[model samples]
Target: MAGAALAGLRIVVSAGPTYEDIDPVRFIGNRSSGKMGFAIAAAAARRGADVVLVAGPVALPTPDGVHRVDVRSAAQMHDAVFAQLPADIYIAAAAVADFTPRQVAPGKIKKRDGEDGLTLELVRTRDILAEVAVDPRRPRLLVGFAAETGDVETYARGKLAKKKLDLIAANRVGVEGSGFESDDNALAVYWNGGERALGPAPKTELAERLLDLVAERLRA
Candidate 1:
């Protein structure tokens, strides 16, 4: 692969898991360790692209030469990405929660002695990728992740069209040691005219391969 294939390009990437607060002491979140997105950011920077990484809560060190913005919630992630928009590429790798508590409790709720059960109302979160895809200043290439367990290709293709993304990276979630919070990953990439399998390698190798494919698409 040419090291300068993505030279001078600007890339924006979102990584990690968004937290939705239920109370001051409790929140809803996923198990994304942010390894994949961080790997992508590092790969893009290595390819000489200016990278802006909008990250959620994670312990990964900042990749050399990549600007990172840390955020906690899905809404914050969405805002951060758009604030630094107009990039050449946008990759939505964060495992964003689909719903959040309708209202965050001011304080922890006390358990009722006689109550048999409790119910909580939830609301759909803003579809960050969909929002960004429809923006007038959206990036030239938009990539989304469809973390599905079954019917991988069908769901990925659907998301590609529904989100109006240039490409979608599909992976199986909920399998034993396969998806969320895993260090090694495999991807089935789908686009308008083609699809390809990426890997079961280390995150860094997969990132490099994915970047190469992105560069090829951009050049074409």
Candidate 2:
């Protein structure tokens, strides 16, 4: 990190939660704060990597020396990521919505009297990570993130294989002081046959550690 460890590398990172709109004023989203991906971009740029961040709707400022493309929905993020790709590394840290409303109402959905509940038909959003894994322009090191409430490693490993990713960082989401909207996080990183535990520390430190692992993987 003190030198240009990632020099000459092109990296793409995605962060934050995709908002799947239900109506003009309502949407389905998650708790991701975009801190982790931004930190990664910052650290990578500091290490002399050309970084492009495809970010979701988050209030955080763009990291210095990093190019950013802001997006609101999952589909836009997918397009933005691919546009910047053929990168040396791709880190998918965004918590994209699994489902979106099949049809979006053009106007604000109004509550009707005596209608206590409303139902919405939803459809699966494109699996951006899975698509990236199979893309001809896929990066050399494809990394993903899994935020889970239970069986973290088990789920993370499953996703790694399912998405054919080179590495994955998994963390528990329901815990206090870590994961989603918190400044700190802990990650268990897994590859084909190896894994490492990192943090319970600040996200900035975690990002540096994560990049260190990425550099080591690139060397191998």
Each model's lDDT comes to 0.91, 0.94
TM-score of 1: 0.97
Model 2 misplacement above 4 A:
1-3
Name the candidate that leads on lDDT: 2
**Estimated TM-score for each candidate:** 0.97, 0.98
- The sequence of per-residue lDDT tens digits that candidate 2 reaches over residues 3-23 is 355897999999999999999
- The superposed Cα distance between candidate 1 and the true structure at residue 90, in angstroms, equals 0.3
Residue lDDT tens for model 1, 73-156: 988888899899888899999999899999999989778989988788989989999999999998988999989879999989
* lDDT of model 2 at position 214: 93
Question: What value does the lDDT take at residue 93 in candidate 1?
Answer: 92
**Segments of candidate 1 deviating more than 4 angstroms:** none
lDDT score at residue 23, model 1, on the 0-100 scale: 92
